[model samples]
Target: MKKSLEKLLNKPLPVDPFMPQRAVITDIEELAPDHKKFSFAFCDESVNDSWNHIPGQFVMLTVPGAGEIPISICSSPTRKGTVELTVRKVGRKTEVLHRLKPGDYVAIRGPYGNGFPVGIMEGHNVLIIAGGLGIAPLRSLIWYILDRRHRFKEVYILYGTRSYEYVLYKEELKRLRERNDLKCLYTLDKFETEEDRRWADRKGLLTELIPMVELEPSETFVAVCGPPVAYRFIGKELLKHGYPESQIFVSLERKMECGIGKCGHCQIGYKFACIDGPVFPLWDTKNLPEMI
Candidate 1:
């Protein structure tokens, strides 16, 4: 059985890290004015099911005549044969991507970067906090844990957006709220309408939700992904709540040109965000002041 398992694990997969593969878009869903969720499949079916990636890893995508950009894999590995990317249009490459319709083919490479430590998180209560577009990568972790719910203890999710219209993954969040196995809290920066007030459980900074949830500092793992401005404030709150710096993980956003470490665009202090992380623990990043 061990030999068979090793063989299965070693099987080849599509979309090599260095070589770009052709993938056809199967569906597209517009989550917000500037954000869209894209679903794709490798044009070659044989390698579709073989591609495996952990949550929090990212892939570089290429749009012909435009350029390539790094995007987080939003779908869980449990959903085999397909990959999802949630893109927010901010630059030329993303603008071109936004114009693409279903059935278009794009070049894809890599499931790059060190991801969240799922092995260590197993059997521990998990708290995931995502702000704005940061939810894209964290969503992968959320789904992975939910799929194997029995392997984990308590699970809690805190998501904050700019407003009700800016909320990403609204339908799925609603479904998550219905699940008895976990708990979810949604908040917005400001509430404009009566409906908005009624829709949200809270309306303020996401950090406010931290104190409301019950957490076991020693047995709980906290994963945070958000804007650079949110780090210091959120980190301070988590520490105040009794979580050790080592048990708290953060995902940093950097300008990455090449998906590999050769590019200097994503270099921070002595480490490369592309290879060393997009996800890192406080213990590993504390000395690197620029990362926080």
Candidate 2:
């Protein structure tokens, strides 16, 4: 009788929520000509262990005078002690971030936004597509997947850049290719000459290379990260190949002020890019404006 009454109530219980904590910059390194990878160590040791995050989630980085910007958490959760972020010097806030040095203090607000559905993606073939600096965010997902290679099926990565010099994770890509667990492809937009080429792989937009790769649209899950133009074309190509809209995910670039939902700068219709998504299912934005 008591068990039946408990089931009938159907009351939801409250649990602890993930909260943001302050962290300080411990180190910074230049990953590319214009991109800097920053590492932050939490001052409080307890926060370091408690602050759990998933791939594709972003943190709101704050500098005193320059305000804040949402940057993807580039390091995998498997990595402990500190978190990493790769930032391209694109605007004022990033320019300020570039000026920050080791030991300098900075404020962090969150590890916000929905991340890649790793559990759901397990046991399936995965395709990761990244263009230019877009590789920064996708790097997190790639690392996490690589760390737990046995859980998933065949994994493929297609990375494209304007030139060989612009490739973000060249060494890492090469190492990953050597691993039997994954397959990797690197492409460039244009090749100056046969002699000038260091990367002898594919050449052209990422969309063109999609058709050349062998993938089962229904069984494979595609994740793309790039500029607005890249997202538009790559997404269209994936759809043309018969991939389901729900299986395709894209990361968007927006001007994010506050990482929390309170700031309206990054709002798109009813969704806040910082809160609702930086990575979203393709079907969610099929008709949304200024999202692609």
Candidate 3:
């Protein structure tokens, strides 16, 4: 099953999606060096109480004098009143964001884009795969599925990062691996360090972990979020083992430059990444030009 384009087109924002609203950073937790999870509560009490967003959708966060950047929601919609974004300090915009402290203000808006197909995914087996920082958006889906565990049959998480030092949400994921309800498999590119050996399940590229998973291909719906270059290889490996291309969804958050379609930077063929998707079926890369 898939999200219908007709339904998505009919959905409209209650207010202007691009309109910025003020929010204050309530807490900031350092997940790793250069990576921080910032918690925000809308400045207005009503907005803070009513704010909700589907997993995989993103918000345009304006860093005051810096600039606005599209960052995916790393927190679950199941948690209300506050939202969290795990930001990696990579460029000028993020570097500015990282310098800010709790209680600082930022103008933010939009839970834009077609999110994960949670409606149809109920009752199906789910495989969540993340590479490096790709775990950001998928973290929301992971929590959503776990909070409502009875709705789905089986769930698996396969995450790969450069090394033990590069792994995000280290403690949370370590606890998740202890759960009996779902499976969590992790791999690292460098495992020479004793910490890496103690933490990771394997060492190699993420694609190498594919064959180790045991799932019924027809019943499984896979969600992948990672570097764009990994898409082709991940898709190829999944398809090689009988996974359906239509059932595999990939988040293309990197393609988004602006939250509204007015900016042409996120165009892939005729589709606008901001409006049409930040999440798309794996088959779309084959049908749409320059999708990857």
Candidate achieving higher lDDT, 2 or 3: 3
Per-model TM-score versus the true fold: 0.94, 0.88, 0.93
In candidate 3, which residue pairs get closer than 3 Å at backbone N, Cα or C atoms, i.e. clash? none
Show where candidate 2 strays beyond 4 Å. 1-20, 193-196
Global lDDT for candidate 3?
0.89
Q: By summed lDDT, which 10 consecutive residues of candidate 1 come out lowest? A: 1-10
Q: Estimate candidate 2's alpha-carbon lDDT, on a 0 to 1 scale.
A: 0.79
How do these models rank on TM-score, best leading? 1, 3, 2
What tens-digit string does per-residue lDDT give for candidate 2 at 143-218?
8898898888888899888877677766787788788878787788878866217673777878877877677888
In model 3, state the lDDT of residue 74: 96
Better of 1 and 3 by TM-score: 1
In the order shown, what is each candidate's alpha-carbon RMSD? 3.4, 6.7, 6.1
Supply candidate 3's per-residue lDDT for 37: 94
Candidate 1's C-alpha runs over 4 A off are 1-15
Per-residue lDDT for 1-292 in model 1, tens only?
5335546977554445787879999999999889999999998665475677889999999997898899999999888989999999998889999999999999888889988999899999999999999999999999999999999999999999888888899889989999999999989998998856865789999999999888788899999998879988889899998999999999987999897999789999989999999998977667898887
